[model samples]
Target: KGISADVINIHTIKPLDAEAIIKSVKKTGCVVTAEEHNFLGGLGESVARTLAENNPAPQEFVATQDTFGESGTPEQLFEKYGLNSEAILKAAEKVIKRK
Candidate 1:
């Protein structure tokens, strides 16, 4: 996509791709991390911490908060928790401003 030059996806959590993430942040000066897990211990948090320690880039987290999901369709849960693409875009905009 012309909107983004490169996209890197990681699979592991414990040993996150800190170096690659930092490299991307160094180039973009901002980041938006999306994950299906809770924000507290999710990949977004780890990325935020890494950026804070290395270069301190602004980061948006698109993940569930410290809350549990209810017994409903996945779409229902996503809408209820504001976890859709619109929400992520809004968060990314906000984070970019903060940067």
Candidate 2:
């Protein structure tokens, strides 16, 4: 867990900061996109496409798999959907290994 990471907080997906993403990946050589939305058509996908076209790198997505929501507290929901810090850490570790 001693790895250094650059965090980019994108406000919108439509105007996704591809430049920021590319710049970060250029420095880190890998990326982990953590989003509360669906992994299929969310920021992760956009970032993946951007990376794939411009600067490809090892990438991991920490998002809700294409699954329906269930009744639960926020903590439980986040844990079940892999939207927690631990999930991000796991994803980051996985991506770094691929780098």
Candidate 2 at residue 65, lDDT?
90
Off by over 4 Å in 1: 1-6
**Candidate 1's error at 70, in angstroms?**
1.4
lDDT of 2 at 90: 93
Per-prediction TM-score to the true structure, in the order listed? 0.83, 0.95
Kindly give the number of clashing pairs for every candidate.
Answer: 0, 0
The stretch of ten residues in a row with the least summed lDDT in candidate 1 is: 1-10
Candidate 2, poorest ten consecutive residues by summed lDDT: 62-71
Residue 60: error of model 2 in Å? 0.4
**How would you encode candidate 1's per-residue C-alpha lDDT over 1-99 as one tens digit per residue?**
123423668688788989899888888778888776788978887888888899897778888888976778888888877788778778777777786
Residue pairs with colliding backbones in model 1 are none
> Per-residue error at 7 for model 2, in Å?
0.8
Q: Which numbered prediction scores highest in TM-score against the true structure?
A: 2
Number of the predicted model whose lDDT against the real structure is largest = 2
